[model samples]
Target: MRHILSGIALAAGLLLGAGAPAVAQNPFEPVVYVNDAAVTRYEVQQRMRFMQVLGAAGTDAAGAEQALIDDRLRDFAARQAGIEVTDEGLQTGLEEFASRAGLGAAEFTAVLERAGIEQQAFRDFVASGVAWRAVVRQRIVPGISVSDAEIQQELTRRIETPVVTRVLLSELIIPAPPGQEDAAMARAREVAGSGPTEAQFAEAARRLSASGSAAAGGRLAWIDLENLPPSLRPVILSLSPGQTSQPLTVPGAVVLFHLRDTQGTLRPGAREQVLDYMTLRLASAAEAAALAARARSCDTLYAEAGGAAAAIQRQTVSQNAIPGLIATQLASLDDDEAAVVNYGGSADLVMLCSRQPALLAEAEAGVATTALADDGVEAAVPDEGALPSRDAVREEIFNRKATAAADAYLAELRADAVIRRP
Candidate 1:
């Protein structure tokens, strides 16, 4: 996977049509074949260009060729399975993909065109992905399941062993335009050696970093150390608070990271604690206070909410996952405790029903399941407003198993087919 900083730079470079020169070959000629499907040089060109536009790393000819091959295999399998992406479904997928970059489908296509990518190529690429996911769901999901015993076993294992490390980091990326490495390196060294305050570093980042985080003073959210790239991990681990790293070079960019702080999570690999709570919005502060006074328990509040002009909602979320202000307000409350806050011209009476360590299996499933669920393969779009953090655990686990099954199935298909390259 491309590093986040590199991905950002690549995206910018793609928008500006900056990258290694394109392969100077006949785009219409067939370059490879999967089963009976021909992968034209033109398709590879489009895929490479599109990948570049997406700030993907290693968008070289070989990489593009291999990616096109995998895509061809996936498409062929989807076709054999009778899975097809309707034009409407493809358009929705395009829109959702574009939304990630904060662009509408048309706007994103225009950007691609400006960068010399064809709109049809983008559509074909997305269609393959959508169809392949549907194929996975149909063929593999039925056979996979996560048992309650497995969840309990995972929970027990987590309780017996824990691993925890997290870092607060701010980043700076100086674009190393071709032939400007020395100048960029000199600037990086000067900044790194200056022993600058966090403010000074952030100011430098604002002026020089090419990353999206530059808009936010290059500050990043707290990240688990294990998520850092292997090469970058040691450098980050070595830094003290307020210290910046020596300039490091990545493809097309020179980078420095400021260490804001580092600390362990509450427990090493602890099951994330989830809170089940309800909030009732009332018309007036007096009414809210009256309800709060009358309700000593969450159930009582629920009962009081039935007769009042109240919009009640229940949500389950981990502490850190909650909005900062609300999390802070709820931090001190014990089970069955109530708190009132004013929101949007109304009083919100919140009651805490329960807090417990989420099952380790559920937490793992949430992360794994997100890949399949967010892909919109087997279901309608979920309600984003009411999505619970741990609700998808089982689905995620199922997806993971299904993904493995799908890969095996693909491998069997590949082995049985004759592939050709020219």
Candidate 2:
């Protein structure tokens, strides 16, 4: 594997005899092919070098090849979804990535060039990452939702018992438009009674489900039993592998599930989830729509003054702490998704910035064993445990559900993908 060359200092170390070019490999040779796209030996070497520079020293050529293959799959999924990274967006992405190494894009490219890595290699890598995030946001996230009740139930479970069981499941979520509830239910009943093979269920999900995972065949990875909704736990637990759940009704949709498998393990669960969101009041529905169109994320969505724009406020709180109307509006949304709702005499654009699991975040930081008490008197030690936050538990449960769905979708993509060496 090649070494990652840094600045001018590393440049001299990488130079050949008399500061001439080093020995070359068959750079243009196709080492691997993912579907119609080719992964050249040049690209592999560049990736290996890039990762090494990025501190992934353990990644050899073989590891780089697999990573590039995954990128190919990601790029393909974005293409299938008609997601194109705009030049401006790509540049922003490049700048962001370059900033990680404490260098501007031009400087980073210069360093890579000195190491014989082409500028296009860096662009391709960043572009692929940007496109994949778009795929997840646009094609996978909207379908995964955590309910208020589920949040409370998760808190109760975490306090009384840590979740030990995780289940593999597939889903079919059919939208029941205001006037078409009966029709949607009828269709859902037919699907549920079909005794679908996993393949058949996947096909149905692709064709009939309204979820983002519809593109991935309604598949979901192993999710903890504690993370599931309290009401649905019994129904899901009742199923055996290959058994489909009866059509279950949720707000605005009728859904069914297929149990694939189950497992058990001890894992620390979430105690609370904090939400950071912003809302902009608008004078008219049309105004809200215009603003929503311009809004990509909280960072990008600016609050304007006067006319159509009215008031903007940012708040952070647990899910259950949000007002009923605002919470309901946020339920169907993913991070960065904006929903326009009638709040009194005007329209409100509610945008979610982030929803985080407090306990999980602490755990990752090596501080889950300690936290603030409810009275604000002092922090709790390991034996006393952290203060209970239903919101954090809610956040954890929701994140796991979302992650499982994404994994299932990606698995389908990998399975259908054609990988080869020629």
Ten-residue region with minimum lDDT total, candidate 2: 1-10
User: Please, what are the lDDT tens digits per residue for candidate 2 over residues 139-231?
Assistant: 777887888768755644554443337899999999966555546655776777678989999999999999888988999878988799877
The TM-score leader among the candidates is 1
The estimated TM-scores of all candidates read 0.51, 0.41
The lDDT, on a scale of 0 to 1, for candidate 2 is 0.73
Q: For model 2, name the residue pairs that clash.
A: 271-393, 272-391, 272-392, 272-393, 273-391, 273-392
Residue pairs in clash, model 1: 369-396
Q: Write the per-residue lDDT of candidate 1 for residues 1-422, one digit (tens) a residue.
A: 23333433444455554443567777688988888789898787777667655645325567788877777888888888888899898999999877777778898787777767889988887888898888888887777889965555544444544333789999999987865654565577668768889999999999999999998899999998879986788788768788888667687777989999887533433556678887777887677778878888877776766666256787888777877656766777898888887675777777788775654435445643332456667445442222233335456666678878988987887787779977
> With candidate 1 superimposed using the best TM-score fit, by how many Å does residue 402's alpha carbon deviate from the native?
2.1
